[model samples]
Target: MLIKVRFFKCGILQCNVVLNEGDIVTIWIDPKRVFLVKLAKGKRLDTDKGYILYDDIIGKEYGDVLKLSRATAYLLRPILEDIYLDLKRPSQVLYPKDVAYMIYSSSVEPGSVVIEAGTGSGFLTISLAHFLGKEGKVITYDVRRDMQETAKFNASVLNLQDRIEFKLKDIREGFEEKGVDAVFLDMPSPWEVVEKAYEALKPSAALIVFVPTVNQVEKTYLEMEKKGFVEIHAEELILREYKVKEGATRPKNVGITHTGYIIRGRKSIKTS
Candidate 1:
C-alpha cells in the first residue's frame, strides 16, 4: 500500500514525504530508535544518520529494511496499530484493541447501518466507515460542532466522508434515524441513551457501550436489562506486548494494560 512518511526532529518538528509503489526507505532518523515512516521516490529525507534518498527505496517492498547514509537501518512500512495510535486526536480516541473487539462483537459488515454517538476524534468513526464500505452507512452524532468538524476532517482524510453522516445533535434524547443494525455508545453517560438506542435499533440489533469505569459499565448493563435487552456481556481488554528477539521473548512488563470496558447486548425481539 502507498503511504506517507513523517520524520520527527527531536521528536517534535515533523517533515512529511510520500512513497510510491516498490519504494524502499528508512523510516527513522536514528537507526537505534524506532520510528514510523513511509517510502517514496525522488524525495530526500534528512536525518541524523544521513540524507535518505527516496531512490534508495524505490525497489523495496513493505517491511523491507533500508540503510541510512551512516549505514544504520530501520523498518520501511508503518504498522496499522502504530498508525491508529499515532492519529491526531483532539479528544479521547478509541484504542485499536477495543476497536477490533467492537467490530468483531458487533458483527458489523457491509450494508450495516451503524450508529455511533460522541464522535470523539473520529477514530472509531473511521474504523467503522472503513468496515461498512459504500453499502453501509455510519450515522455519527456529537453535540459539539467543533468535534463534528474535526471528525469530518478525519473522515475526509481517510476517504470515508461519504459513508459517514455527522450530526450535531445530542443523542440523549433519541436518534432521528431508525432501523439501525448496530449502536455504539462512547459518551460519558451512556446509560442515559440506552432507551434512545433501543428505540432506534432494529429488533435483535446489537448495542455496544464503551466506558472508562466499571461503575459506568454496571449502570449501562442494568439499563440494558431494564430496557429488555438480552444476552448481555461485558469485557475489558488489556494488551500486553512480547519482545521477540534472539533470546528474549516474553510479555512486555508494562503495556497498554487498560483502556475501557465494553458492554454489549442485543435488543430483544418481541414474540407473539
Candidate 2:
C-alpha cells in the first residue's frame, strides 16, 4: 500500500495492513495457483472460478476470503514471486529465485546507485527498482527497444517506473555511469563486460554476473580474477518449495532447481 495503514480487522483473516487502491493483490485460488491483480476502482478480475470486483475488497485486509460462486478465495499480499509471476515475458526472463539471491548478496542495497547490463524482460530490473527504495535508482541498458518497452510496462505495473532509468544503449560501449554501488551483468557474454563493469563500479563494491553454464562460469571467474577483482567466487541457488498444511506439509514434487550461476567479485583498489 502507498498510504500509511494501521491495524484493520477482517472477518476470518486478521491483518494489520489494509488493502488500498493500486496495491497489487494476490487472489489465491489454491496452493498451486494464484492470480495477481492490481487493485483499481473499476477493475474486474476475471477468474475461472468467478470474477472479482476490486472495489469490493479495496478496504479489506489481507487474508480475507472472498465468497465466490463456486469457491472461496483468499486475498493475500503479493510476495516477490507473485510480482514476477505475472510479468509479460518477451524472452527468457531471469528467474526470480536467482534475482532474490543476487540482490541479497550484492552491494546494491537501498538508496544505492546500481548499473545493470542486458535488461532482459526487466524481471531483474523491476526487482531491483522495487527494493532500491526512493533514494536509489537503476540505470539499465539494452539494445532492443521492444524488450525495453516491455520492461517499462512491467515496471509501471508496480508503479516503479520512477525509480528506474531505462536506457536503450549497447552496454558493450560501456556503462555511462561512473563509480556506482554495484554492477550486475545478465548477458550471454558477461566475460566481455568485466572490464566495463570494473570501470563502472566504486572501489570495494560488488560485481555480480549471472550465467547458466559451467563454461560461462569459468570464463567469468577467470575474467574477474584477471581484472584484479577480490573475493571472487560463484554460487548456484536451488530453491525447493514445500506445501504447508495441518498434517500434509511436504516438499513439492518439482520447482525451481537450477536457474543460473552467480559469480561475484569486489573491485580491487589496485587496477591491474
* Winning candidate number (TM-score): 2
| Alpha-carbon RMSD, each predicted model | 6.9, 4.1
Q: Write the per-residue lDDT of candidate 1 for residues 78-118, one digit (tens) a residue.
A: 43344453346788788889998998999878889999999
Name the lDDT of candidate 1. 0.76
**Candidate 1: stretches off by over 4 Å:** 1-67, 71-79, 270-272
The numbered model that scores best in lDDT is: 2
lDDT of 2 by residue, 118-218 (tens): 88789899888877876789999988899999999888877778889989998888889998999999888999889989989899999989998999999
- Stretches of model 2 off by over 4 angstroms after superposition: 1-18, 243-250
For candidate 2, give the lDDT of residue 89. Answer: 88
Query: What's the TM-score of each model vs. the native?
Result: 0.78, 0.89
